[model samples]
Target: MQRWKQYGGLSGLFAAFLAAGYWGFTATGGALPWAKRSSKALQRGIQEGGGGLVNLGRGIVVAGPIRKGGMMLEFGGLVLLLLLLGIGMYVYVDRYGGFGDGERASR
Candidate 1:
């Protein structure tokens, strides 16, 4: 595509290098090491502090989890933040329109 070509050749080369690195890592038996490390680190930090920035934001969106007949749904913490982020995005699009249209009301 012209857009891909419009990017300097280095972009394509960089993408190729990234793909090759991922392929080599997978071939060498690395199973999503980045994801594993990030999750463990996040969990450790949260456990040590009992709550972090995400917890604060979650508090704004949810009071706590809800429990029903033997079923429980976690609404507080990161889950609430994610929900808030999604709803915020929807509200933004509803007010300002979505991507790819390029037209917007002048401020």
Candidate 2:
């Protein structure tokens, strides 16, 4: 794996993901609807809501868009996946070591 090949592959993957994300955004009515809903929610909350910032009784509340759009499961799954990936990386680096001074000095 040459450096150029690695960078090129990453660039291609990024472009593909960007295109897919844009397509999905366009197909799903773009950001207009979301922006409108967010503004309305903000105004309504300001006018009619007053409570402690952190309510332990209520537990965790998902964002309004994710909850209302029925994507809570997807959001949760993504969060779990990322959390596992992060923990796995941390464990791997702790056990096998990363780019430490010894490794860098050899190079």
Candidate 3:
């Protein structure tokens, strides 16, 4: 029983580490594909407009500085969410003993 408890604690810690690593990798990796797609779409929208007044308006809203700013905001939000999850996981592991604290210690 005692041995099993120790193993359980270690396993929990390992699981927490794995979860954090996966979340970080996916969040960082996912941003690149989205950024590329957004850039391409913006470019297409700009080219299709062909320098007319309509194009100018479309360009301002979709393909111009606003689009760039929106992308930055999205990327910033993704990074912030990942950071918050990481901090939450760290706190969870710290307080919960990863697996579960021994019953005797809880009192």
User: How much does candidate 1 score in TM-score?
Assistant: 0.29
Q: Compared with the true structure, what per-residue lDDT tens digits does model 3 show for residues 1-107?
A: 69999999999999999999989979889678889989998899788865554555454333455455668677568769999999998888777756465653453
TM-score, prediction 3: 0.30
> Best-fitting candidate, measured by TM-score?
2
At residue 31, candidate 3 shows an lDDT of: 76
RMSD of 2: 6.5
* Model 2: how far residue 105 lies from native, Å: 23
Superposed model 3: Cα runs more than 4 Å off: 1-69, 99-107
By lDDT, is 1 or 2 better? 2
Tell me each candidate's TM-score: 0.29, 0.52, 0.30
In candidate 1 the C-alpha lDDT for residue 22 amounts to 92
The digit string of per-residue lDDT tens for model 1 on 1-107 reads 57767686878888999999999998876867878977998898678775443555464322223433322344435577898999999988778876547666553
lDDT of 3 at 77: 80
- Candidate 2 has its poorest 10 consecutive residues by lDDT at 98-107
For candidate 3, list the clashing residue pairs, or say none. none
Model 2 residue-pair collision total: 0
User: What's the lDDT for all of these models?
Assistant: 0.69, 0.86, 0.76
